[model samples]
Target: MHDFSWGQLVNPEFYIKLGGIYLVLFIIFAETGLFAGFFLPGDSLLFLSGIYSKELIQEIVFIKSDFLNVLLLSSLVSIVGIIGNEVGYWFGKKSGPYLYNRKDTIIFKKRYLFQAKDFYDKHGGGAIILARFLPILRTFAPIIAGIVQMNKGKYFLYNIIGSIAWSFLLIFSGHYLYKIFLNNLDFDLKKHIEIIVLIMVLVTTGPVLFKLFFKKKEGEDDNSI
Candidate 1:
């Protein structure tokens, strides 16, 4: 519930509160790029952060930099996320069976592996796009791809695509949405567009999750076959 009045988030002190947008970028990187990052707040936090940033842009005009700064910050974050995903993939590939079932871990073994495998089995590219929006899944999806020994070329492609789609979508959308409101001097200028984007993301993700879920269930049934 960032105050929509007087723009609290844009305060130079406030923007610096978490090192401005860079903090957001880093969090996105870790969440999207790292498997262990599944525990991090992804969607809700990003959404709220965006809403706050809207106020910042309007109330605090002197950001000490221009939109380029925001772009650079976001791009850096995207790189971090992508690299994190690769490393996480390597770890999952190396440690999936053991660490997954280890008493030290809280991950539900069957659930994690099942979703990963399911996504890998059916829609290879689709998982990357769909998972970009879904929390935790973004980090683990690529790692799962790596564990399963997905084609390196193909994996790289999907990874890049997902990273760009997810990273840009969130950062730019949040910033732009704020711009619209600030420009119009209205509090709810593009609430409809925001809602639409959210719906689109969910609508796009539904089939991927469903396919994975059902595929996993079928695989379980097949085990008894």
Candidate 2:
């Protein structure tokens, strides 16, 4: 059995080295649901899977799966990702009161919870959907929703849409773009897989960082005013 540690979760390569479809699925689930998993390489892992999906299928089953198969399987794992989020929500619902009552510590602050609740209030249902594409927030937003008792119906509706969008977009982008490069450029993707994953990480998170900077700037302007 492979020993799992927090250090290993930062690299998708660790799970890839472990070599099983289920291990990848577990990483996705854990990352989406557990606070400790917030550091896991979600974007890079999805990108890597897209790059390796066909090869992975062949290794496990001795036959290659086409693009459609990769797409379908990616969607299925996305559903599991939704379930993981719900688990996190349930945990927050059950533990939220006690957590709120606990004395504030450096790592665990009540003010942070209040800020999350305020953010959720300002954004409404769409925050859940948007948070899917943003790391850290993706794990905590759902929990904060539960802590604040967000409407179950609205939460589920947005959660489904977000999970499907997040999963399919990243996975298919990786898979198809690799195929395109192979066909058009005579590129050996494996030789530059690490660079490709790094680029994907930036592309995925760039928008979030951009928005955060503007939001911070706006806050400063408002304060100055």
Candidate 3:
């Protein structure tokens, strides 16, 4: 059996070297669809996938062209992401009423569902797309959409658009940016993967943290008054 380590779980390079493109796709699917997968490294994985697109793609299909490899990798990841969201939506739709009526468990809370509903009410369909860029929100957005019975046609459209945009932008940026730095600036992204991952995490999670902090403070202020 393969030994488990938190270090390996968080390291995108470990994933690439171990399972190559297939593992990357699975992580994207799980992170975007499964409630328990919120903590998985989606953004950094995609970025690193771009950086190592040639190697990852070659593992599955030998391709001499870097552009073709990245393109194929991005397209596959996008499709899997869309499928994952659909699965989350289906789960939420099927279990929506049950979730509302069910008592909160140690792991599940009714208030979270309520908060998702309220967020959807305020943001409408746009939340699906916007949530794609945010970490935890992306995982729950589709599920919430189902619980609230969002328009099926509208949700499907946004699902496709958001998945494609998110996958293509991050993966391509990683691949091309690495090339740019290496050729022009003499900086190698591979040598600085840790810093890159840290920046990606902060950049993606910063807004979520900011809102949570201020929201808590506002609640405290109101309680004091």
Best by TM-score: 3
Model 1 misplacement above 4 A:
1-16, 19-22, 44-65, 96-119, 188-225
Which candidate order results from sorting by TM-score in descending order?
A: 3, 2, 1
Q: Give model 2's TM-score versus the native structure.
A: 0.81
lDDT of 1 by residue, 109-138 (tens): 556565667767688788766777776678
lDDT tens digits, residues 27-140, model 3?
Answer: 899986788889888899999999999988888899888899999999999999999999899888988998889999999998988787777777756888888888888898
The whole-model lDDT of each prediction reads 0.61, 0.77, 0.89
Better of 2 and 3 by TM-score: 3
Which residue runs of candidate 2 sit more than 4 Å off their true CA positions?
Answer: 1-10, 58-65, 100-115, 217-225
Q: Cα miss at 173, model 1 (Å)?
A: 1.3
Q: Is candidate 2 or candidate 3 better by lDDT?
A: 3
Can you tell me which runs of candidate 3 are displaced by over 4 Å? 1-4, 103-115
